[model samples]
Target: MKLKRLQKMSSFLHVVLKILSVSSVVIAIIVFFMKLFNSKNIIMNKLESDTIFYFQTEFFAIPDNQQYIQTEQWILVGVAIFTCILIAWLLWIASLIFKDLSTGFTPFSEIEINRLRKIAGLLLIYALAPQILYSVLHTILIPGYSFTFGLNMSFFFAIIFYCLTEIFRYGALLQKESDETL
Candidate 1:
């Protein structure tokens, strides 16, 4: 593709990504507040209608003498909202990087390589965030929760980004050498 057309396409994509990121954040905030209010309503309704009780367990199966009572919701909405924001922020950063690279510079620029590195780091974080959040939520909300983990395809994208970062770094180094020799 022609450099000028490529530049235009990249700029267009950057704008689109920025718009998406902003919209995602706004939607996430809206969803969080809405869910919080909904959960509160649910909790209130439950509290008015029934008795809530939780027995203290000394082990997985044994209930101890201690007992507790409450009517509340764990409200996973916050976690979901935060995850949306996190992903949106990553998209924003990516858009910024693409915008910067969309100028009339070669792809092997040092700036491009650094941006790729940042993207790689973000991808790795994105891959890990859900697992970490799941473990935390499980421990907090579920009694006697066992350790659970599973690898998914998203991890492959993380690995792909890491490899791309290394490849970009190598390309930047070679470009620098070529420029110096010229």
Candidate 2:
């Protein structure tokens, strides 16, 4: 009965994750195009209103007067869209894992273990890639723009997932042994 409940919950979660993943993609695309076409007009209006819209960094602020700020802002938008897509991809992977669980596969099964590892790897990439790219591009493209790189919670989660993968591997081995002895 407990297993059935778990399976039902996993199925529900799987569906939810899949929906969220698709939605993220759609939203990212919409945002990207909006930024692409409307950014100049929006920035110009904000500037006229004296809204003091500037791209501020830890070290310095590039005000709207800078010729390259718009280009930099566009690049930032692209990065944000890329990150959103990456998140969507991660959600899709998680949905697949949940789908496996809903199909009555044990957590210790090979498929789950592999999927967990993939999630871990992707998490690590997700954690590091954006920061590295942001730091590099900003420092290089924008004068006097310096960004400090740091690890975030997703990195820790990646480590935890990797540990979980090993635990699941051990459990699978033990399960195999128990089944053989039965």
Compare the candidates by lDDT and give the number of the best one: 2
Model 1, position 87, has a per-residue lDDT of 76
User: On residues 1-182, what C-alpha lDDT tens digit does candidate 1 reach at each position?
Assistant: 78878889889989999999999899888775665577445331111122132122122322541221121133245555666787798788778776975776777877777777777777777656654664566455545442334444556677898798888889989999999999
Per-residue lDDT tens digits for candidate 2, residues 51-166, read 12223244444555377778667667766777788889989999998998899987888878888898899899887776567667777776656554555677789899999899
List of clashing residue pairs for candidate 2: none
Q: Which candidate number would show the highest TM-score if scored against the true structure?
A: 2
Instruction: Rate residue 158 of model 2 by lDDT.
Output: 89
Native-to-model Cα distance after best TM-score fit, residue 40 in candidate 2, in Å: 2.8
Off by over 4 Å in 1: 40-75
Give me the displacement of residue 26 in model 2, in angstroms: 1.3
Residue pairs with colliding backbones in model 1 are none
